[model samples]
Target: MIAPPSPVPDSKISLWTPFTFSLFRAIWIASLVSNIGTWMQNVAGVWLVTILTTSTLLVALMQTATSLPSFLLSVPAGALADLTDRRRMLLFTQGFMACMATLLGTLTLMGNISALGVLSFTFLLGMGAALNGPVWQTITPELIPRPVLPFALTLNGVSINVARAVGPAIGGVIISYFSPGYVFLLNGVSFLGTWIVIYSWKRKVAVSSVPAENFIGALRAGVRYVQYSPAIYAILIRAFSFSFGASAMWALLSIVVARRLQLDSSAYGVMLSWLGAGAVSGAFTTGIINRRFTVNQRVLIAIVIFTGTNLSLAFFPAAYWLYPVMFLSGMAWLMIMTSFNTTVQLNLPKWVQARVLSIYMLVFQGGMALGSVTWGTLADHFSLWIALVAAAVWLLLSAFLAIPFPISPAENLNLTPAEHWPEPTVQGDIDPDDGPVVVMVEYMVKVADIPAFRQAVDQLVRLRLRDGALRAGVFTDVTNPSRITEFFYVATWGEHQRQHHRFTKEDLAIETRVIHFHTGSVPPRVTHYIAFPKAPNVDIAPPFENMEGQS
Candidate 1:
């Protein structure tokens, strides 16, 4: 039978709009299986560690084992994602995780696994996840149209929550009847579905004739972009603070199930499923939330609700009370996470998308890693109830961070590369690898417009730095006040070329506003300069000879 047609874009788009595309649908379905297996593995891994050691620190360390890799490797992985074939990267990461899970299972089933062994294998699995995170995040926009991106992200969250609702309970059953080893084995096997789907489908790579950036350069560029982007860094700060505070639930919930509630693994899984159920419910109502609340408002509301969930964990301790509380926690998590993630995705340009995303993942996962250890330590020394209470208090306090670093909307600005810049003219052929390139734009501004021009130039400085400029400056002519020259330095000729292509419509708009201050009958005069190394009788080989062979 023929498959149903994909959803058409119109007013009031449905969350399932992304599912209409065959590839997104297939990947989404496969992700459900993989996520289910992952959640199952999580339940098993934590349960295995908890069973092996009665130490609350060791139990909490399970989360640390899983999260720390993402904390360390996300930025490099993100750079790799942007620099390489994302589909192949996804395949490799999936296969790697499968192997790690299978080996962990084999060892566990043989009764050779120790607490250290479980944490070690979980760390290996986390490495695979770290490598996978950014590439997977970057691919969705390519798979579907832009208008449906928000829905796609929401559905992706739904997929995880759906798996969350079911996976842990099933994992608990497997753990109760079979063993944690079986859960690991099942998780390993689950990755094959996604691998197979990815292998069968073809992915189109964007063609670029410009020399590809070195890994170090890419990392630096990524950092520079985020360094100057207030909107992005604001999100990063908010995300880190939220993750740091919210991680208490993830780190200590299993312990609470065992000690506080006096429940078996199955009941622990059930509690988690309630959390997932709440998230799933929250995912459906996001459209309503979007319409009624601002991004900051939504985030604040979620944080408040999540604080209540933490208080519930500390004070209630009963399963019945936790059922709805867990649900609320899940909803809160979905709101906060989805808000941060979706905002980043919407604001990014494709060139540095994965790299910035990697930084985002780094901050996000780093917060969780550090927070897990912190809360765990608190639990071990003081009490689990105390840890939960402190986390609740911290979460409430973190809400105040939103006031100074509120997230901005990106719907007004177009981020697509405009390619508006024409190739620069040169008197002779120049080496792409030749010394630092300096670009200067000279404009004649009226005395009155100098103040306004300087205001616009301030914005232009950030745009230059965000694109690739190492240093940017504005100089006024000593003799003629109207002669204002703006200059920026880039590392190399090739990098400068890449910077030309990196300008998005938003950036061009900023440039346009800056140029509006120029009162010259003609447009601003632009010039390029490349540095030459000073040497005495040095046999200077043509730079192009070496640069030609370089990638």
Candidate 2:
């Protein structure tokens, strides 16, 4: 069994402890500034669309344009993050967004901007954000020690919410007193801080014996890993459900303030600020909540609270009531999102973290994009109240999903690399890009242990596939009733080598269980075979004699 991580001193485990690390602190501060600018830009963009068009669909479409890129590009971006230099990728994406924001601000100031123009720029900015997200997340582990990683994640959330709390009110004030163009321009300038911080970071490059996978290979491997991981799938499902329902308020808040509450831009900003305030409160308290509740319980409570808030927002017309309701909504938002993110992180090994996270990002954003349009169309056709009520109903139903797909904490799982697999014995030189490689592991099992052995090997098949096996199965010897051979295929010798690196301590435990069932005198005997084309007349021969080994 894998041992638990060493205990962090209680004094260093508090909410603010992540700031003790210099790099994390620097990056956090810079990111906070950038996130504030982003929130400001969001406020300006949404408000601008509302002003330029009377169509609720068009206004909602603004959110769709921004979120759609995350759905389309997150997986590829995640693959890139895993396969390339993450810091440099972040710098490029940030710079690209800054340019997009600047161009948007310029056009708006020059009186050359239209609804379509705003959406085009918003889409471009979204693309940059999508590309930057996985890289940014992957870098966090490099910045802070494991003892404080959870706190660092929470701190990241807090920074965003803190920006949300401040940016909207400030953006609203600027829009009211000066112009929306100024808010956009400020956002454009804000990216410079993040760029500088990323550039200044002297990040250490990881040295690996094997080269990184090609883009397509990385993408496929990531997908395969997630497919076999039930924990990740559950998290994705919950995230999508929550995001779909929660998107209503986010996508239509400006319109809701304008049409339902009869409020000005400044008032709308205050509403958003209150929501952010609730989020901040939730972030600060998450550590305590996590200690008290299970993952499933936390998610359930958050959903119920958020649903109530949505229903209240739908029925209550008073402006003052929105403040308390939105505050509650913010709290629920934090609880749900933080739980989902932490659960996913805990379950994943470093090898596939970014790729799986990208999938999570895709589902979350895709749900929001689709939900925005649905709610907007409902609002346009019927009323805002009906739209919100419908969304609230859906959220209420989503709470039941947790029953079948319960969220489990990953503390018990040993995800650290085991590095226990012995290197394959090779008799001759083999190209790294050689043809498909087949491996056979022979086990001598008594008749009484065959059923148990089969079950154990079945589990091994999944692990093998998750770690890059192309195909896997078990076979019985025709002449020897007690001989069982477990076999698997990999596209290349290089992939089989990579699989050795992917094995975790938990996987090692499983391997131990399988080995106990083997009744062989020594251990399971392993053999490797590489396929080659048949010559015109000559028979291809096996490379080595006694081609047997052990793992």
Candidate 3:
């Protein structure tokens, strides 16, 4: 008799526990500093653009420039992260960003910076961030143990918000006393801290026996994985919706503070601090909140609350009242984002983790970019109040999406590879690069069991496709009602071998269930066929006989 599965370690992680791990602490602190610098740079960049041009469209485009690169490059970056050393990749990107910031700062100090120059620098900085994002996320699992990973992720978000809370206020004072150029210079210096941390990290890289996938192939696989995963799709949709609406607040808040409230840079910075304060509070209490509500419930509630905050900001003229509204906005932001991010992190397997996360990032950052442009134009043509109200309405309508696509808990998903498939028996030397390969499994069942068998095979189709099958289908014999054939095609023989390595414990369980339904005296018959275009005279035939006990 088989034993029951082992229980997952209870993850009663506290806010400070993750910091106990020395490496995690080092990187976390470094990352926090870097995030503060980034926010400071953001405040300076937008303010600089505003000073150069009063056009709302151009001011909002600064936001777009900072996010659009993620949409364009995240997938490729993710693939690269998976293919190469994540640490080195981050080092390169961070160094490049530091150089770009320094150049922009130098130009600004020389009074040579223009509106176009600021946008260009922002885009370049975003490109670095876009490439760095997936690598950064994928490396988190390597930094600490699994039980405390949730806390680490939560702390990471909190760190960003902490920086957001502090950076803008510091930036405002500096810009007031010194200039925006000094802010840029500080941002440039901050990148070195992260770079030094990464460089000093002695990461042990895992070496794989199988050849690494080509960039294009890896990208395609990542996209296919996302397409087949319902959980990821739901998360991405929610991310897009929430980000598209929330972006109006981020893109237009400076304009609102300056023009509507007639506030100086100092007040504007303090207002942003309130939003960050709310986020910090939300992060700290997220564990308690999650315990009280389901993911769907929490997400919906957060959306409604955030919408209320936006509406309050639009209609209410008093700046003091807006402080609380901004605070609520920040809280709602953390609740929704943390929910989506934690869900994705738990659901993904290590093999495809970076690639899948890149897609999620793409949707999230893309929505912000698109929304910034849309809301900025709306504000230019109509009014800031109208744009804010319209965005809130869009956010409220987003709640209905929860009905069709509910978020599922991923605690039970065993993503560890089972490695149960036996190595194929081969007749002769077969090239790894050999042409398209076909895999077929034959099953014989009682007439009554056919329906159940078909249902099982239908479920297996998605697994087959997700694991690397280019195409998969189930077929029934015309001569015998008891016979069923399941087949899938792969691009190359090497890919078929990769698929063998991709099966998980859950997949093995499913395969066992299908096998139990088979009525054949032996186990299901399995065969593999490889195409050979060079030898037209050769007839490739099945190499194996009936295997009764093998599954």
lDDT of 2 by residue, 1-551 (tens): 21223446755487787777767788899999999999899989999988987888889788788877887899999999888888789889999999999889988988899988888899999999999988888777667656566677888888889987888778888999987888888998989888998898876776877646889999999999988777788888988998999898887888878887788987887888788888888877877887889989988888788778767767777879889888888888877777787778778888788998898878887888789889999999998889989998999999999888887788567888898878877766776677598899999999999999888989998999889998999999999979999999998878888888899998998888889988878989998888765112337766565555623
Cα error, residue 364 of model 2, in Å, equals 1.2
RMSD value for candidate 1: 5.7
Candidate 2 error regions (>4 Å): 1-7, 10-12, 45-61, 103-118, 175-182, 251-267, 376-389, 478-481, 534-551
RMSD of each candidate? Answer: 5.7, 5.9, 6.6
TM-score of 3: 0.88
lDDT of 3 by residue, 1-551 (tens): 21222323456566677777777788899899889999999989999999998789889899789877887889999999888888899999999999999999999999999999999999999999999999899877777666566667888888989987888778888899998999999999999999998898877776765656888889988998888778889889988998898888888888888898888977877888888889888878877787788889888888888688768767778789889888888888888887788789878888888999888988888888788889889999999999989989999998898888888877567878888888778767667777599899998888898888888888788889988899999888999988988999998877788788778886888788888888878889998888866223477654467555568
- Scanning candidate 1 in windows of ten residues, the lowest lDDT window is 1-10
Clashes of each: 0, 0, 0
lDDT of 3: 0.84
13: Cα error in model 1, Å: 1.1
lDDT of 1 by residue, 68-124 (tens): 788889999999998998989999999999999999999999999999999999999
lDDT of each: 0.88, 0.84, 0.84
Estimated TM-score for each candidate: 0.88, 0.88, 0.88
**TM-score of the candidate numbered 1?**
0.88
lDDT of 3 at 286: 74
Give Cα distance to truth, residue 167, candidate 1, Å: 2.4
